[model samples]
Target chain A: MKMEALVHLVSAIYVVSVLLGTHGPVYGRLVSVNDKPDPKNAAATARWLVSQNSWGVLNTISSELGGAPFGNVVSFSDGEPGKGSGIPYFYLTTLDPTARNALKDHRASLTISEYPIGTCGKVDPENPTCAKITLTGKLKVANGGPKEEIFAKNALFSKHPEMKDWPKDHNFEFFKLDIEDIFLIDWFGGPKPLTVDQYLQAKL
Target chain B: MKMEALVHLVSAIYVVSVLLGTHGPVYGRLVSVNDKPDPKNAAATARWLVSQNSWGVLNTISSELGGAPFGNVVSFSDGEPGKGSGIPYFYLTTLDPTARNALKDHRASLTISEYPIGTCGKVDPENPTCAKITLTGKLKVANGGPKEEIFAKNALFSKHPEMKDWPKDHNFEFFKLDIEDIFLIDWFGGPKPLTVDQYLQAKL
Candidate 1:
């Protein structure tokens, strides 16, 4: 190989090694630091949090616990890794309270933290600079027809490869939060003034 | 140093390096794998999750959003590292929605995931085997007295050193989740059959 090509090859290997080294053990995909939007950009940052994270706390009003807010750790996908739609989709089973509760009362929220993305560095997870977004809306089955189901499956299975082999009897189906409100805290002031339309329309 | 002592020193360094290599960037503390309780021990597992995790999604019925379940990422501590009290505590300010919501209606839950502890390995975060816990109950201020506040401050600041320096004008105060119910999923069957009493009594 030419000297220039050899240097490029070594640099490529170094980059790949760093990515793998820092990748969340469960989320074995790349979350490029370069792709992260600036904290000042509310809409873009919100979209980035939803798009980059593999799992978040999916909250629903519990039927079992007297309508108390119930939050469960869940894996979600907006789209294939980089091509996210900013609308988080979840694979849930009715056996779990989150799904059953959503079925009865669709009021729910999906909270994603930038802390897990490794970009927060030494910042405390609760620190405003770390960034967190909560998309509050109705959680319901993705009954958008066979086309949407196929898209949901592809989106989930692409990022979480293990989901494709999960027990068939569990009856895991795609559910999504129909975002009505967006609460993002990327900087010190407080929740950013972002709209659902702004979040979905942000270029990720 | 003696040759045997030198060998021991090198081994210790190797172990420390491995531990730091896997520590979450935001949670700059050690969570030993050996300290993890057995999956079959419901109460023990619940306490372990509460103790080991430095942060979780604190859910509240949003007062602003017309009672939608709002989940926000927040840092918490049950006690100092390896000495947890089974009940999680937080340093929150009413300036944020979660604390404000909690003040209006105390019903809340704190959802914690074992994935961030770096113990789940290659298992998908949503998988039951990865372990997740939701402590549901009232979220109220720690008005147990000055003694309790001191304990809360120590529990928080020890794990999250930076929290001690967070803006004092924000009026951050100690808040504890008065766990009325424990929903723990450490293994495949379903939510563990563990009660609040069983969880609090478990030796950590």
Candidate 2:
């Protein structure tokens, strides 16, 4: 094959392999890019990270642990698959300290790493180039009536089907991070100066 | 071939495939288990998590964000390779808020999820069967003798080789979570009742 044709064939095979990997359902959703957005496009890169991940560390102030910062592993969704709104919605129960902590003090942050997305390749998770975002804001329970609840549920259940069957007795309720500050590190130098508005408005 | 013989052959092939998959140096290090320990072994399970994971969300009280719990994606190690002491060590610099926060309050937590280990199978990350651990306590800079620094560096560099090459001008120093509490959920009715003593004493 000609060099140009060979390059096209290789790229096609790579895309096909990634698509095949996404069949796992619970993880491995295809982002808009086969790789990732350029670090300079802060909003797009941040949105892509949130859209592609299914779980992250949700931080809350712990009343039980003498008001210490507590981080918990929780599954989250920005929206149903590719239609991410960039506002992470979570299903949390008061039984867990994270939700309980949030009820008392709304100040929280959700930290998501690109490592688990399988796009960081061999880079260290702490490496600035690997990309990490901490969306700091209020952790508010969804009390915006039935319409909002429906949207949150659809957004969550579409990605995590098992969440729908979590014991009803647990009283799991919808919660969201009302993003106020965005701290994103995608490359060397320092955090990209991104606003909540830019992140929410970014075309993913 | 006999049915038992065929089953054994398949199992061997499965093990070989997992070993082959672990060739990626940065992310895919082989843990002690071909499968995770029984969830009933809380101490053992927690130790396994700390030993196996190289990175997790390190939470700290952010002075900049009005004492909000700030969780950052960071790489860590408990000890050198198979000799994990179950006391998580870190390489941090004051340029990062996490280290500065630790210097002020010393309260922190490190949360690790088993989902990334690839041994969770198809289980949802939030599911109790998939396992998660949070070590809550003081985040102290390693002020011990030169021997302690060497131990911490060896522990970190063995698991994260690239960490050794991180810029010297960054002024990275060793730190460890002086764990006072242990929270683990493997196959849980709730958080496992493992104590720090049990976690530190458990044999990996």
In order of appearance, the predictions have TM-scores of 0.89, 0.90
Chain A alone, TM-score per model: 0.88, 0.87
Candidate number with greatest DockQ: 2
Cα error, candidate 2, residue A142 (Å): 0.8
Best by lDDT: 2
The CAPRI class of candidate 1 is acceptable
The candidates' DockQ values read 0.43, 0.47
Residues B1-204 of candidate 1: C-alpha lDDT, one tens digit per residue: 454554455445435544544333334245556778899999888888888889999999987987899999999999987789988899999888999999999999999999888678677898888999999999999999998998999899988988879988999999999999988999989988998999999997
Candidate whose TM-score is highest: 2
Q: Model 1 Cα displacement at A136 (Å)?
A: 0.4
List ranges where model 2 is wrong by over 4 Å. Answer: A1-24, A31-35, B1-23, B31-33
Per-residue lDDT for A27 in model 1? 48
Candidate 1 residues A1-204, lDDT tens each?
454554445445435544544333444245556767999999999888887789999999998998899999999999987788988888999988899999999999999999777677567898888889999999999999999998899889988989899889999999988999998999988889998888888886
